[model samples]
Target: MKKKTPGDVFDLHQKIQSELNAQEEKQRSALRRSLSETKAAFDFFTDLGHDSTTAIALTDIALANVLEE
Candidate 1:
């Protein structure tokens, strides 16, 4: 078998580094997507809570009017 040269070792090291960088980028992208989804879910729940409160208040007012009649 032939011995490897320094240039060959350097190329291999660069290849490994590129692969690691790609993997790290993918992880960062996934984390960003997860955070966006979580924020959307939080906003949806907040809106739902606001709607529920408004509905309850309207219902109470309706009940009071009916009782007074």
Candidate 2:
């Protein structure tokens, strides 16, 4: 049986930490790209939402005016 040395353990720990850091960086970059895409789409949809709301309000006003007779 071989005895484990502190240097061996430290090297293994460092390797694992380095890999984790690299993977985390990849995830962060992907998230940023995804967020930018989503935000653009979100802005477009928000404009559509405002237009729809205005249309709906106009519809309701027209209906109310008709019923006032």
**The best candidate in terms of lDDT:** 1
- Candidate 1 structure quality by residue, lDDT tens digits, 1-69: 989999999999999999999999999999998667555544565566656556556555554675599
Give every collision pair in model 1: none
RMSD of 1: 15.1
Candidate 2 per-residue C-alpha lDDT over 13-61 given as tens digits, one digit per residue, 9 for 90 to 100:
9999999999999999999986675555445555666565555565555
Top-scoring candidate (TM-score): 1
TM-score versus the correct structure, for each prediction: 0.68, 0.58
The clash count for each model shown is 0, 0
User: Alpha-carbon error at 45 in model 2, in Å?
Assistant: 3.4
